[model samples]
Target: MPVHDPYAWALDFEALGLVPAVGIAYSLALRRYPAERWRIACFAAGLALILAAFVTPLHTLSMHFLLSAHLLQNVVLAEWAPALCVLGLPPALAAAACRRSVVGTLTHPLVALPLWLGTYFAWHVPAAYDAALRHPTSLIHVEHGCYFVAGFLFWWPALQNAPHRLSGGTRALYLFAAFVLAAPLGLLLALIPRAVYDFYVHAPHRIWGLSPLADQQIGGAAMALEQASVLFAASTYFFLRFLGGDERAEAYRSLQRSS
Candidate 1:
């Protein structure tokens, strides 16, 4: 397919403002604590992935053409980006942030799970999806912002690096629940007889001449695969930790001693 807007292909600085904002915070963070280069690198890499997903031609293609691209963008923004950024934080800072009064309530699995899963389904509602597309200026910001925040909250309570520690079993359960929660949505998207969203159905510049329904299914498959890969790894890690019993705890002790 011919490129849609050759002129519009210039680097999309406006959509990429988060990089510098996070970079500034990272620089400040390094000043206050030991400059563990790995942590800084993780944050920077997360920011770069977000840029690739949203600021590069991927953004244009997703917004203008393909549902697969849009789903991939959501994974980058809502899953990988937040997780990596959290991993990059100093443990002390994360613990400090977690100590706040509101953090206890928000980080609870009951609260976080619903918010993340609810936001995920809510945004995919036809009216909501179309509205975001129609009013790209304001509503789109709301959609993106909510996803990113909810994503962070969803991961915060389950991540090994989270300031507030969860029992291994609890974390494993959370990951399993997330996988269960997402399964139906992905299945519906993938197996639906026709295109669910009218927006993509009528979208102008489809790559590879893919029919809108096929595009929708592909996106759903992508979502399902991505969810499975991440959740499975996390769940297995925690489950093994749970199984390892005292062995895992001793390993952590050994690690701390070497460090």
Candidate 2:
């Protein structure tokens, strides 16, 4: 008789090996760049949390069948990873990197834009999603790569940390536009009546024993929530800046009136 233990199978070599390698490489790159020391620390911490999601036993257990677990994964990918990466930027490092011949060509808006959208779509497809579960190593590569590229594009305008920075108002518009476009993508996933991935649907269940459909709903919700959190945070920052500028202008007007 053969025994199947989800817990035991969760701690696979791929999960253990790939995360540390990627995390270390990211750290090394941070060291090479001229970012603030604190920002580098934040980046490292964020990557560690993100990587921990994959390498730890918790991720393994979540894969067996838990919508909450899946949500956690999406949160780490979209929100946590991007926020930390953006915090590390100050424009200079990005400008330097973009100056490289290969990077210059790659970072061109045309090239980076499509790669971001394509990578985002490709990984979510059923075939790729299923393949990721079957081969955890490949999953790490594709998933992390998608987050890295997507984060870069998503942060470029707002961070003003790119080789080119959008005007303040323009940055706000870009963020809103992204939020609107992304909302539909997430809603599409959430609204699907049937299971999109056979692996997830057929996989043995766990963590409150939620059904596959329920898990899918949670995953969609998770993505939406992640997007909302980021949009809100960025928007709030912009709003505050705008308000501060307005207050300064009003104060100047009052001084002129007194004079």
Q: Which stretches of candidate 2 lie over 4 Å from their true place?
A: 1-34, 89-91, 101-114, 246-259
* TM-score per model over all chains: 0.89, 0.75
Write model 1 residue lDDT over 116-188, tens digit each, in one string.
8999999988789878877756887788778888888888888634455777878898999998897777778
Model 1 stretches astray by more than 4 angstroms: 1-3, 6-11, 160-163, 246-248, 251-259
Task: Judging by TM-score against the true structure, name the best candidate.
Answer: 1
CA displacement after TM-score superposition, residue 173 of candidate 2 (Å): 1.8
Identify the leading candidate in terms of lDDT: 1
Candidate 1 residue-wise lDDT at 119: 90
Error of 2 at 184 (Å): 1.9
